[model samples]
Target: MHPCLEQADILELIFKEIYYRPTGSHTEKDLLALALTCQRFKEPALDTLWDTQLTFGPLIKTLGISDAEKESENDAFDRDVRVILTNDSYEPSPEALRRFSSYARRIRRISHVPDARSSILEEMNTELAVLVKLSSWVRSETPGPMFPNLQHLGFIGTLSWTSIPCLIILLESKITTFSMYWGNLDPKESEVLIGLLGRLGLSIEFLELTPLSYIRTPIDPNKPSIFSEMPFPITLSWIIPLLKELRSLSCGSISLNQLALQNLASRCTFYKLQSANTSDDLLEAISDPTADILSPFATLQHLELFEDNFRDFIKLVDYMQPLALQTLILHHTAPPTASTLADLLHSFSEGQHIASLRQFSIKHTVSEFETINSVNMDIVFDGLTLSPLLSFPNLLIVEIDTPCGFDLRDADIRAMAKAWPQLRRLQLGSKIGWGLPPSVTLVGISELLIHCPRLEDFVVPFGARTDPPPITNSTPIKKNMTYLYVGNGRAPGDGSEQMALARFLKHVFPDLCGVGGEWMYEYGLEEEQLDWAAVISLIKTQC
Candidate 1:
């Protein structure tokens, strides 16, 4: 044996490196070979290999309850699949059960994906049932939980009757993180899930539930699914008090209303919510006039809402004065009007979030069948649309992606740079329309570098047709900026213009990494893209 392998810590690290290779045969093959090589290498090697289990095939193979073989050659679709067939009468010996227990206790995470495409799906469910049945026998003779060290359990695929029992048996009070993305469930199945949550008690800290998917008229048109009516929200409300230790939650919008009723929302640290409900329902859920508390999310540190309207977003910001919030993100389909945007900012100025807020982003996506260019030109974002955000002087990151043109001038850019002197990232106007050329020029960007020397990722629209302002001795060289994007920027695309622009960027941003637009050639920037690409090559040679 090698000297390095004699040390337990060094041997574990070596096995871990082999076990975690992203894409290679050495991941499992090398670990398995080492586990069977000798006694010294066996324990560490097996522990490293069985640390995380994604499927039930390995446990079934170890228990000798099933045999896996390739499908028949006649079946073209499943020709490469190895199908498992269980032996109902088979039972492992005492020595084999002890070995299985040893391997099972080593697992820390079990992420079950029950949507395998081949016959293995049912076979794996059968194998899981067999394992659950054997778990009692093992526990009766040898005491303690089947998976004593399991902490994280995830259901990435659909859940059915056969798989639900497997999850129930694995739901230990010691588990801390649970995430599931199951499809629609019947009333009985939903109750079983609720019972499982009750069993989980206060140990879980991170819980994420993806919205269930359903067909319009799968069985009956008039009859609604059990999950669509009110079982989900009711179940969540019943389980809220049991989750006193939960710190993070991500679920549908209806659950927010339910959470508002419970006392748990006040203690949550992070929330990422989305909704397919109407704007009225969203608004009502976020801000209930009848509620007693003024701020439901006072202790939240991060909040991210998606697929809601601008009105609902405004209401949420106003209602949850988030005293300690550090991050706020909103993504909606409807465009925000100038007055609505002003009201939203006014809420921020009056709220207690001004002191602790560091990152604020709002992204809008155009409705289907309508692109940014096709939208009406009456809706545009100007300097006033963003000036109100200057109230939060501690901001470090700000990103706004609107589906309209920006009428900002040189003065607006300078004002923004001066307001957030500690800003590290500033991205605006991602979907630049084709109405008018940007009035800001290269000189305005120089003002940003002058104020915020630590700015790293800068994306904005500016005119590149003219020469930059003269550099003075007081000018500073900003080496932190890596990527500078000029989306939908107006450029002359001439040799003089390219040379002058390259010299100006090199002097101000000496360590500039890349020069290009955010949406390269997506809209009609083919000519402008070529000009910027040339400037990138010139900057590289000069550096």
Candidate 2:
């Protein structure tokens, strides 16, 4: 009797520990083993065992079935579990179907009874009967809400068109997020599902659709059609009105026709539209007036445009100005003419457009340095003044990278530092034909310390073959410097120039906390071997 009492106490401790463990740590099999251990362990272990999110396909295949024996077995399994069959490749054995149906029915019973709070069934690719069975169980057996805490649902592969209307009816009021991939739903069927969500006044915050390869081809361009006239299996137009409550949206690569873009933009506030290996037809769609219906992205704070072919920045500038945006990023190489730069800057600077601009980034792609070498660096420096007009008096970050041709001059550096007195972070990169003059290098660093007294980060990449000149300033180094990055190539005079740079940094910028080493290849040193830590430490100690 004393030994029995001790065993009961040990069992109680194990039960308490299991109850406090986080939900995702254990699998159903593990919990089942614990349940079989003793009567004391059975009840608590069963509780954790049944509260599960189960996926059925991989589990079924893992048990094994021959290809030739699958069809009858699958049919038998479908009847018992109510799984609707869609794809031709899958065929489960009768015994395997029986096992699946038993387990699914058990899960349903456990979820619907008085105690369970949350459950999930994901990636269902089964037949219609199985879905109907599950939905009917939820509707009839569950007491208050079918799935009171059900928050996520995912579908992969196709479902029979007939099964969708029933599935939509069951899911309309419960799920908050739904995702489907590689599935085909005919327009009429899709409309029915949309109508169900509309009738329920459901609020779905996220929606994603990934089209199968066969479904991605555009309808014959030679024919005239409305979106409804297209022969494709899916039309998002029917669901657009219900999508107004969404805060985030991601759609797989699809050709955007004017009607589709207009409908989507009108519904969603934050949007990302991406197309890879684009065609001429899509480009034409963007240039058309209908595209503007989505324009200025009035409530959009972040925007990314890819695979674009507009000749100039004028269109984007005109379209985006009214949004009063905060962040802008432009990719792909565009010819940077002085007029083009001035005009682009003027658009953002004038009026109330982008008055809240805090971060701006422009990335150019060009192999030969000569293409970018043609632009006058002075004009580029002057163009930066355009920011103050937008009330960005304290521009915090700027990144400028262009291929080759322009060199930094002393006057260019002075004008930029003077123009944005409160600038705190700056990154500049120049390709082949561009190198900063020694005077420009010294004055630029000097002017940065003077005008932007609060500056904490600096990255300057010099692609020239000349040595940087010494700083002529008599003022002491400021203690505010915290991070620095410098990438320099081999200069003509070699070690002497490197030594000069080391001394200037050590004496002039004594408080430097971090440094990115110069990469000078000719000194028998690998690019990565440059002693950045040593330099920064030395500067901090000296200051």
Candidate 3:
């Protein structure tokens, strides 16, 4: 046991690379091996080894099985290795206790993913009981708060909604970052959830609460219903004031009622606020002139409006004057006209809010099937010079869509390029509705390449000219141009013209990488379509 290896800092630095390596396969294997090298390495290496665990199986293995004991194989969390741990439980031996104490005490994060099998309830219960018991045993004096070193904890969605109360109490005030993705929380869990929010509200710096899954996922009827007892709305008032330390918060389908929105607006402080659907109230409440303004969320740096109810957009935009707002995302609903998009960009043009914005996206909601073929955006690109938007001199990403149709031509694109020459990621145009694609040809695209040298990722409507350009060595290498996902499908699928256009693009932007939509390859006079590979092939060959 050398003094050099005794340093936890050095060992942790050495072990972290293996522990957090990208590939999932036992990243901790080397750390475990290091733990065996010497007693000094044993403590630090074991600490790094058990810090994050996929299953408690590794910890359960530390408690040796007795002759009479047999672990249940009912639920196979990891089918590769089956030991459900419910069969015949045994008390921890002195040697096992010493070993468990050595490692378990060093745990900082626990990712408890219960089996998704039919017996998930039983499996989660069994696992929770073990954690409750083990933590109690490890910290003898305390009945709960098992791992004093634990600061981050996560629970899988497979558990029954009934077990949330117990889970919350088990966490107590020790953990500062918590994530629970339980899909649906019944009325009973809501009561526990409210209390849990209160108890840990002050301590939590980062929180993720997922009580509901995506809008498309069908509800499990056999499971307890979320609406059974008129589910309690989770108001921000319950959290915001208390959680002065809160920096990041994410809630899925949890209602942020008016009272909560008021508190947030009035207090007007936080780093990030992201939630789905609840912004209906937050937007309305924050927009209210009489809502006790510190300019209602002026301190908000990042705001993601995935609101299901996007009724008053004009009003929403009126109140979106965040002093430090950097990234803004609006999901679902009618696409904003170029004029409306200009205003949002204009918000950054003036005030102390100047020049800090980097990414702004407005994606039509995915859940709305009715809008699949409906007209959402019909814009006259000539009217939307959006020159004021160019005031954002350091802009990095801009996606203002016209899902219905946009009358964008070559001159309009050249004007756009003149406005924003620093954009790295640009996603314009739309694919959902029935309309003629915006009239942007290779000439306009050529201007974009010539102007924005740093352009890397792009998704825009593209069309080839009736008379294509003659290739020459004058084309500057748009080497930074990489990914392309065309919103509008192929413009001219005609064999020679389209092929020539592809060849021209690959020539000009010698490193031009990909084209989106249905891909087809030229076969003599005709072309055979192979949507995926064919389009990618167009972007590779150097001019």
What's each prediction's clash count? Answer: 0, 10, 2
The lDDT of each candidate is 0.64, 0.46, 0.57
lDDT of 1 by residue, 1-543 (tens): 212113456668777777787876575667877766656766776677777877654654555433223322224223212332344455567876786777778788878765355555564454465556677766765677778888888877656766666676677538888877634555456556755776654688877765412111112212333544344333555566677777776553323334434354445453533333333444464455554455565567766665345766666565555456778766666667777777777767787777778998876643334444443356677888777898888899998866556788889989999999999988776644324577888788888878987787777778888887877885667777766767667655777777777887888778777766635536665676777888877778853
457-520, model 2: which lDDT tens digit per residue? Answer: 6655432234444556554376666555554423333444445555666666665555443333
What would the TM-scores of all predictions be?
0.66, 0.46, 0.69
Q: Mind giving the per-residue lDDT tens digits that candidate 3 earns over 1-543?
A: 122223556657766766777777554566677666756556556667677865565555455442112333332223212233343344455676666655566778877776444353443455565555555455553334556577887876544655554475446647778787745555455545654666564677777776332343322213333434434433334556676667677665555556556665565346666666444567667766777565677677776666434445434545665466678767655455555556645544664444677777666655523335444445544325455556566677877544546566778667767767787877665543224654776677777767777788666666553545677665646756665554444445554555676676666656656554422211232232243235346555322
Q: Give the poorly placed runs of model 2, Cα more than 4 Å off.
A: 1-242, 248-257, 267-296, 307-312, 319-321, 365-394, 410-425, 430-439, 449-457, 462-484, 487-500, 503-543
Best-fitting candidate, scored by lDDT: 1
- The candidate with the higher lDDT, 1 or 3, is 1
Cα lDDT of candidate 2 equals 0.46
TM-score of 3: 0.69
